[model samples]
Target: MSLARKFATVGGATLGSRLLGFGRETLMAAALGTGPMADAFYAAFRFPNLFRRLFAEGAFNAAFVPLFAKEIEANGIDGAKRFSEEVLGVLFTVLLVITIAMELAMPLIVSTIIAPGFVNDPEKFDVTVKLAIVMFPYLMCMSLTAMLSGMLNSLHHYFAAAIAPVFLNLTLIAALAYGLWTGADPLMTAWYLSWGVLVAGILQMAVLYAGVRHAGMRFGLRRPRYTPNVKRLLVLAFPAAITGGITQINQLIGQMIASTKDGAIAVLQYADRVYQLPLGVVGIAVGVVLLPELSRALRGGAVKEAANLQNRSLEFVLFLTLPAAGAIWVISDEIVRVLYERGAFSPATTATVASTLAIYGLGLPAFVMIKALNPGFFAREDTKTPMRFTGISVAFNCLLAVSLFPIYGERGIATAEAASGWLTTVLLFVTLVRRGHWEWEPALFSRVLRLVSATVVMAVSLHYASGYLADWLTPQARLLTQLTALMLLIGMAMIVYFALAFAIGGADASMLRRNLKRKPRPETAQEEADTSVLPPPQM
Candidate 1:
């Protein structure tokens, strides 16, 4: 498939998943609010969720996809399958052991590592521990699912893997609905949700495994042995995993700091959910498609093609994210109040969440840029450099978060995250340029400048538009009125932004049109032969 079509397939599915995620968050806001129960549930969810992101989504795929693709191209189907089986055997064994250990150590982890603040409230602390234990098995399921997803993506079957997350949201939403209908206690409802997480993990893994099978790859469990390729994969994956772990650790630090204040953790979680929509849809989708594509291009000695793809991906990300960041910053309050601020969610909570979302919005472009740029290094199997950069960013985040938390509270934590994101993006960009892995063309730079200008125009328009609808956005406004005003405001802002972008030469209308119409490039024998001698990826 064309790059744009692959991106759309993954991006569209991700959009569906994110929309359901928003619904799930909305229900949770109404059902649990920012109370202790909400805090406990989110805190519990955060522990396993962080590990899942690090191990399953971020690090594993970064290392797995490129190698798996190389194997498929070079060694054919059977070679790829054998490699996958070896990796799976070792991976499953490791994950199984870790899950068992974590389950046993849940109390210690919850009390010290995950949410130390909960220690002051014995009930909350105990509840968090229980919920975490219930959800811990999700780690194993998702880690395995991630491996299967790598296989599917390598085979150019992106939809099933991309859409698997919707099941998680669906499962959670159902649990929340049942809790409400049955009038279950808040703690009981959280318990139900934790179990739902486990079930969803299993279901998501099953879906992806089925996809891999349908793609004509069947994996069976074998003795846990690290064959030569598996050993190479592990070596490459270790640094990437460390990088992912550092990112997660930064998040954990923020959560720990947020946990000191009542309801701060939940507030951060809610804000994160809001910004994650754009991040997942654009940033993640680009990363997913770009890595394999770049790897293939480079393997085929199509360096120019690889560079063009990177430039286009960067342009697309900025084009989308800049406007998204602007709109979110402009209408954060209205968005938050409309989506949340119901039931037990108070106006004060809404305001806090809105401010947090605004700060996160400021970093949205940087976050997306990181996603786009990292693939440049990763596709060439240069995980160590990114790992080093991630370390620096995480250190900065830790120091800044610690310094600012006393003054700015949860907003400080959000600010630290945004600042660190930009720092990481800049570092990655500089490294890429220095290594000649990425080059900034004049057109790309000009377009980026124009995109920024267009975003400013959109922001100014949204500022006034929001003022005009201030009454409808108020907490006391009817829900329908609030929703209608918010939707219209967003729609108008999108129209203004795109129009300004096109007028200012910020966007390439023809390029996008071509992207939509471009045909898939068939794999050539020369390309396969080129990949046959693909040297083992550098550590």
Candidate 2:
């Protein structure tokens, strides 16, 4: 498949999921607002999600996909299918044990891991524990889903994996809708939301499994075996999991520190949700598709082709992410208010969330850059390098959080996050350069500089326009009209930015057009002849 088409397929599905997620969060804001109930629910929901990133996104797919791709390229589809079954059998056993243990220790895990926010309010703490218990099993379900996703992605079936997240958002929205129609208590509704996690996990796995089967692959419970393949998968997975764990730990630490300041945790979470939209669309889609493709190339000793693909993907991320960051920074406040200012989310809450969003916006490009670049290491099975670098980033985050929380409160926490993100991005770049894995690309740098100039123009124009529009956004003003106006202002800013970018040669519309118009280039089928630890054939 063409790279652009692949991205479009994944991005389209992800955007749908994100929009549905927005609906879920909006309904949640109306139902729970910024209160103890909301805090408890978020805290409860975070536990499984934190682990999901560690195991599913971070460890499992990072290790599994390259190996599975190699097997497919070497031994054909049937060989890869057997490898997947073995890996899945082992994965289920391990994740099941971990889930049961976590469910049993939910209370202690919440109170100890990231529990400072609940210390002052015992009731909220108790409720958080209860909800966490309900959601903890979601890790098992989602991890399995991730394995299934990795398989489908290897088969070039991005649609099913990308669409799986939509089910999650849909399940939550369905729960909230049911609660609203039935007039249930908010806390009970929050509980229902927790239950939806399990439901969504099951649905996501089932959808992907069906996709895999339709792709002419089948998986079943295999007799547990300690094959060399399984051993290598475990060996790779452990450090990879630790790497994912470190990143998760950074956010958990941020949460723990922010917890001491009431409402701070939720503020960061909401702002992150907004920043993550573009990060998801541009960064994640590239990372997911690039890793497997690059792995196949690198394994086949197609160093030039791998490097070319990496450089091209890097440019794509920088070109798209830079303007996205600018748009987010320019419209942070208006975006927050427009999306999240209903129900118990008052004007003050809007300002707070928006400010946090702006700070996070500053780091959006760096965050997405990491997503694009980290795959370079993972594709080569060099997960340890990224893991070590991520550890340093975690330390930077913890130190900043401690020093800033007492002075700047929640905004301070957001600032710390932004600072650490940029720091890590720079550090990673330097390390890659030193290792000769990456070199200075003058074209990419020039594009970034041009993007900076365009942002300045957009920001200056926005600063002027917002002054005249502020008066029409009074508290007594109709929220819908005011929100529409706010979006119009942002839309105008985007138009100016893009127009300036094109004029100044910061963005190449032809490149984007070519990317979009490209078609899929499928891999040539291989015979079941070899199973080496090295790479596969190039397309």
Best by lDDT: 1
The residue ranges of model 1 lying beyond 4 angstroms of the native Cα positions read: 245-247, 515-539
lDDT (Cα, tens digit) per residue for candidate 1, span 147-239: 988888878899999999999999999999999899888899899899999999999999998899999998799898868888778777877
Name the lDDT value of residue 266 in candidate 2: 74
Model 2 Cα lDDT, one tens digit per residue, 1-539:
66777877888888888888878877887787778878888878888888898888878667889889989989999899899889888888888889889888887888877566697789989999999888888898889888888888888899889989999999999999999899888789988999998899888888888898999998698867889999887777766776655545666887888767667777777777887788888877987788788787667655555656666777777767776777677767777776777877777888888887888888888887887787777787777777777778788888898998898777777777788788878877887678666656787688778978988888888877877787656556687777777877878888998898889988786657653332222332121123223332111
User: How much lDDT does candidate 1 score?
Assistant: 0.87
Q: By TM-score, who's the top model here?
A: 1
Off by over 4 Å in 2: 244-247, 513-539
The C-alpha TM-scores of every prediction are 0.96, 0.93
Cα RMSD, model 1: 2.6
Tell how far residue 34 is off in model 2, in angstroms.
1.4
Where is model 1 poorest over a 10-residue stretch in terms of lDDT? 515-524
